[model samples]
Target: MRFNRGRRSFLLGTAATFVADFVLLVPGLLSGRSVRAAGQPVSADSTVITVDSTVIDVSQGAASGALALVTGTTFNTSGTPEQGVRVRALDPATRNEFARVFSDANGQYSLNLDPGIYEIRANKSGWGAISIAVTAGAGATHIVDFGNGAPPPPPQEGTGLVTGTTFNASGTPEQGVRVRALDPATRNEFARVFSDANGQYSLDLDPGIYEIRANKSGWGATSLGVTVVAGATHTVDFGSGTAPPPPPPQETALLTGTTFNASGALEEAVRVRALDPATRDEFARVFSDANGQYSLDLDPGTYTIRANKPGWGAISMAVTVVAGEIRILDISP
Candidate 1:
């Protein structure tokens, strides 16, 4: 459903720590001869060496608009990464698809979108389609992953039809009503059709969660959640004259930081991670740029942040964020 609201831009936050240490040893003499140094080498006393530490601090603040990100890998039923799967996100208000992409050779896809809730779907030839719902608040990042963990769904069944009729508040057959059958697990549409003059609609679907809805103009009916069996015609009816209200607007927060190396220089191309404190699932990951600057916009909450680089050590810290606040942190490794 559409709501009257002003559009805003998305914001980003960065993460990093700032701490370093150094240890130096002096050479000693023995038996009036310069003690031969072992294989160990030492820098001149005048030379300064800085060793990066793994401590990070995160602060929070408000954001006007926020940049939202969705990224994850796609795998097959065999538990192997798969490529070329079509990933899609649908805008709730327009019911029109806003973003679509294919998994790369590594079976990964990423998309940047405005703050809102979306219906995500993925499918590939020889694989069963999947769907799920995700809420991407202003300046927030979320990840939705898909895989059977077993074997891919076998070939789809060729039989089964879902039939439905729609009636108006007056108990008369309603024509031109839009009907949709969805898979609740992936929040994906199995089929969509409109009612005929007789207010009858039909869709052939494989057995799964039998969720369906009907909408006409600005009014709609409550969703019917049920289960369907193969080769059966499931009959459900919609007779509501009410429209669901719009969801409340979401608040946003900001997080940002920089990454540095042992020499106290900005380090670029480091992968920074944000995880849900309770589930420990990574929700977002961004890389440092040429200047070692990074940023994120997110819904305020407690999260575990981490930074990773190949040769340097990894760092992890926990922090809480509140709406409309800015937090700055530094990381060294």
Candidate 2:
């Protein structure tokens, strides 16, 4: 699928806030000291320094120089710092990634870059990704953060939850399948998501009748209708129990013959052409060898076979070939 610049920007904005409550940025020059948020429990893998309240001062780090500094923290919906999220800096025009780093045990990362416009992305397996656009100037510092908040909360008043698993025809869980909620009356899609590794997906929607559809490439889609109620949960599953049959193998046929003159003498170096009679489009061409023998391999079809020589004139005949056939015809031209 392809998206224009405007559409790409819209999608990035929507996904950034999809589940995350909000992104926080504390941009300023901090003392070289790294400080953690008071009373926050430290994970076993956490580093000694954590930046929760202020941005890290690049001037004190190895990146100190004329290069611009980009820094941020990764956190969960509840504002708890998350470790090991991968952050990337990409060229805005070409969308080519130039730099990447993983959040430290303190859920913090810093990147130094040349002055330019960039698309910053944060991602991790199993969790959705978020991205933001930024402009970095020489000798400047910018802060950006990312996270898709926790799972959807219980349906509030006037809203309900839908959850399900997508399966293949053979009854095995199918990951990466797209699941969508559509308005029953208008048939317009309202929300969509890709199933996770375990084939699980969920959507929070307003109370109404909806068509829940599951789709994946190479497989027929499945859908179900449900009447949603406020503050309730619904479960739905998709797929047929039987598997689809395998595709047929491809096969070819061969056409071989000898060329002869009108006087019944074997003629060598005669040009043999095979063409589609209806369109007169040539498919194969070859010259008779010293022994007056030539061959053409083609798919099953009807073709116009023509043999010609400078002084021997030409002969045209309609020949039919079927799969696995080795047809032989003598041409006297």
Candidate 3:
């Protein structure tokens, strides 16, 4: 209180030094608002997403009670929001996650980002990845509705169509020609058709190697290899042009079997026929000869032998007949 001039000057000088030090460090210790790179205070903004002129009903992952707009999805997760399932602004060019958001239990997320394409990935535990594209613009409210799964993709064009006709080697429309398409390398048939009255056959097939075979009774079968390209027309013509007839006494699967009783006595006057399992259709039938031997002609197919007599029990078994091969179905009671 009674300091001299020199003492008073020292006290004033010390106070000035302390004040200067405090001012220098005040900027660091004080809590200040977030600043932009240009030193401007950051301001809060609302995120908005617009629904485009797309068919929203069938949009990807659109289902019950779900509303879907561009800003991702607004949904109800019940109780609490699933973590990691947040709203984020992605870099349109590189498609990298840039911004993030968390949805409340009512599934509300906001991404106040600039105008660009952003990806919205959900944190749906135990579920597959769910994502959507959002076009965020200034002064827009993006309310995307997400359900438990992904949205359905847009509709596509009709499946490829295959069209054509089957003609006999004589260049005439032969009705009842069963045409089949087989994969060239696998030889597995996937499509079948019948020639119309005009000997026309058509099919829509995926692009692949295929074999078109024209099958008819009495006449030899005709086949041609074809490669179907996508969106390209494949015309197959099995011109009946000058095809010779099968040689006389055309070879067929001729099966011969003897029928007899368990007592070793030959049974005669027996009615026998080959049965097809797939179609349940019966083929040719022949009676037993005097020696109890029976013969029948059939195409290469798995067949069953059925026998009937006035007093004897019927006998039958399955027989697999390969093309140009003979198979015997012995009769047993």
Candidate 4:
């Protein structure tokens, strides 16, 4: 199953306006392809170049081989969809440009390429540029959003920057994981953001001690304590150590049910989630099917089951499952 999780929203201050222009000497394209804009170019040799209104079409080149689709949206520092953002795919080893396109008014773009590993770069005028490595598989569509790497305003007085990456149990960079910085004494969250496609994240906070935690659904969480120093950048990574051994198999219980609306009619597309009461960690989540049915298999334990839909109030109930037993719990309203 494919999941296109939403990117984290950022609250960045306004950026300085500048003029940028550069030339791209792509192998097949015309030599000295100059892109003229009003701002200072971020990188003269950048593999990706942003154009004001002109879009260089390279879809035909990509269509000549086995096809893989790359699609995503582009957002500015203020978390607004940005139009005309240029997205380019290039060969990682040789830095050769493969396909190029510009985002639409909705900040959405798509590119076709041969199945392989490539560096994808996204850039727009007045915003910072970003490049991330991605593996494109034949006939598969991959999502890569350009919402990070925006040059943030200078840090405030006595504040420092915290930056790091999040990895999974296998030590592979994991995207869309939420990272939070909290005050150790009060346990109040100071800042929170999701990692980018490269599994990288950054936070700016005042000089103080904080507990940084990284978490994602269905994954073990890792955290640490760090002291933020004035004018210094601290690096902290999560789940980058050796992978732990697999756990022993345990007996599981089945939970299944149907959902109905307040009017006693079957309801579809309701989100059902089960959470561990002690740690408040989510154990399973699924949406009701067309028949208003949902199911989950979990280890024997007590759980808080909650069901909610967009236009209705949420419903919650507590239940305990027994090993090798099937439990039926229906939800309404």
Candidate 5:
């Protein structure tokens, strides 16, 4: 349509203003700036805008093809959860790192990785690093756990270690001593180790009360009681010097006795008995032969002697026996 100068100029000015607004908004949109609609600025709430040209896979939750998802957890050598451990997915063929993440508080981590052979490594401070080879499939989920290159930990949790030193009664470090950790409740030796040349020893053990026994040849054995806590190293010391006192001299006293009837003649087929003066406990018993004589070895102690026969009355007397000495006693019934 033909228009007058005034109307055409006005329309031209309005079109130019609209074009300028479009140009300014274009840069803002690319820079993540919010847009206003209907003359009011949009709130901070975001709206997801999808383009028709972009295709999404309903089943895979990605485009027609995407990288695989890898999830796993990191643990210490003792199998305790290791949070904040750094995990990396490496392509061994190219030695390139494709993805990296830090483990969560639960020691869990996830990564979107391209389908290929990868070397997954996990590392943390004070822990041995671990790496594992895996073949990831596209659109597939895989798991790879790490335990600092150590064997799987025992099922029991929160276990700890015990360490100690062995010393002689003279306060000198004792080497080659055998240290044993015994479970008090079960009375079983759960763990054992030897003291090194420096008299240092260690044992990984469970939490509980234990008796640590240290022993060696020519040295007396010593034991100490300890209570172990989870994830802790309990230290103990043993001064096990000084040889045990010599065993009391073996009993070697000889007691010879004769049983006789009221006539004071040798009584054949008679019974002779020796009893301890204290506790009234029977100490020894012997029977006289056809000659009515019996002999017995006993510790050096005082004892009561008695003579007995089925038809004869019982006779009793007090006798003292001495070590390495032979004593003769006569019993009459």
Candidate 6:
């Protein structure tokens, strides 16, 4: 797998906190302190493992384009325990996964994922996080570590912390609203917030100019522009667009000739769906009509026609076309 291993640049003097008052601290566990110059020692029973929380700054194709890797090492213990570590990035209404890394002799692993809320789990290490939500800006890095070790507590002095809440235009609380606060100069989404039942959210960001937007459900979303002076709180809200239109029908690739099982038998009742590649959304779904044949009229673009049968395998092929374009596809498993 292609893993983007970018060294973290900035470290948050304080350890990671999944939420308020809930620190990722274990009573007897003191894994992180200082092991800069050389590699640290790995004991058969490692309770002290250093951690690093890196804030990523990125810009590219989609919001899900910026990907990074998270990793660390533990000693070669006599009995290998499944760390049970799971890592994923958080979007407004969804959680996307990069991958899960299990410890080995070197006690190391990593995940390739984009920016957003990242929930990590280490059952064997007594570590659990709902989602270490992150809003990394392009080219910027924030370090967050949790394992056998961690950093010290946050200092009283403000390192440029800015905050605020999100609400709909009607002043109603918007849950799962995708709020992005961007730093005008760097164009980096410094801090991100989501409205609670009270239409509230907050972020710890550096002092500067920001452009915040609100995404509410059912109603048209709004973008509220504001500036976050040194250490201050700013409130903003907008109506999310009308309930997103109903999801279109599922899509299936069009089949002209015979679709067969590995044994040259006609494949029947294969589930197929037509897709709108541009949005990756489905349009319509159906069984391969009686003759083991099917047709799909996809929204002009690129599509991967898929064919599947219970006792047989599945096959898919990519087809590209312009508006009102039609293509034929066949499958054999």
* TM-score result, candidate 2: 0.35
**Top lDDT model:** 4
Worst 10 residues of 6 by lDDT: 16-25
Q: Cα miss at 245, model 3 (Å)?
A: 22
Question: Model 5, residue 151: what's the lDDT?
Answer: 31
Choose 4 or 5, whichever is better by TM-score. 4
User: Quick one: how many clashes does candidate 6 have?
Assistant: 44
Per-residue CA lDDT of model 2 for 1-333, tens digit only, reads 111221232223211211100111122211211222232322222322223332211122323455676777877545677787777777644667656666777688766666766666666775545544555667767666555333423443456777666677566766667777776445577666566444556666777656666667775455444556678876666553322211111355667767888888767667777788998787666565434555565668899988887998988999998877667788895
Give Cα distance to truth, residue 138, candidate 2, Å: 36
Evaluate model 1: give its TM-score. 0.29
Candidate 1 global lDDT: 0.53
lDDT (CA) per prediction = 0.53, 0.57, 0.44, 0.59, 0.53, 0.38
lDDT by residue (1-333, candidate 3, tens digit) is 011221222122211111000001122221111111122212123211113221111111111122222334433323233433444455533656654445544455444444444555444444223343444444444555444322322211221223444455356655556666665435566555554444444544565545555566754454444444555544554434422211112234556566787677876556676787677576655555334555554566778778877777787777876555545555645
lDDT of 6 at 310: 83
Predicted structure with the largest TM-score when compared to the true one:
2
Off by over 4 Å in 6: 1-164, 185-188, 237-333
Ranking of predictions according to TM-score = 2, 4, 1, 6, 5, 3
Every candidate's CA RMSD: 30.9, 21.6, 27.8, 19.3, 30.6, 19.9
Candidate 4: worst 10 consecutive residues by lDDT? Answer: 1-10
Candidate 5 displacement at residue 250 in angstroms: 68
The TM-score between candidate 3 and the true structure equals 0.25
Q: What is the TM-score of each candidate against the true structure?
A: 0.29, 0.35, 0.25, 0.32, 0.28, 0.28
Cα deviation of 288, candidate 2, in Å: 57
lDDT of 2 at 110: 69
Candidate 1: regions farther than 4 A off: 1-65, 92-95, 150-333
Clashes of each: 29, 2, 29, 7, 0, 44
The lDDT-based order of candidates, best leading, equals: 4, 2, 5, 1, 3, 6
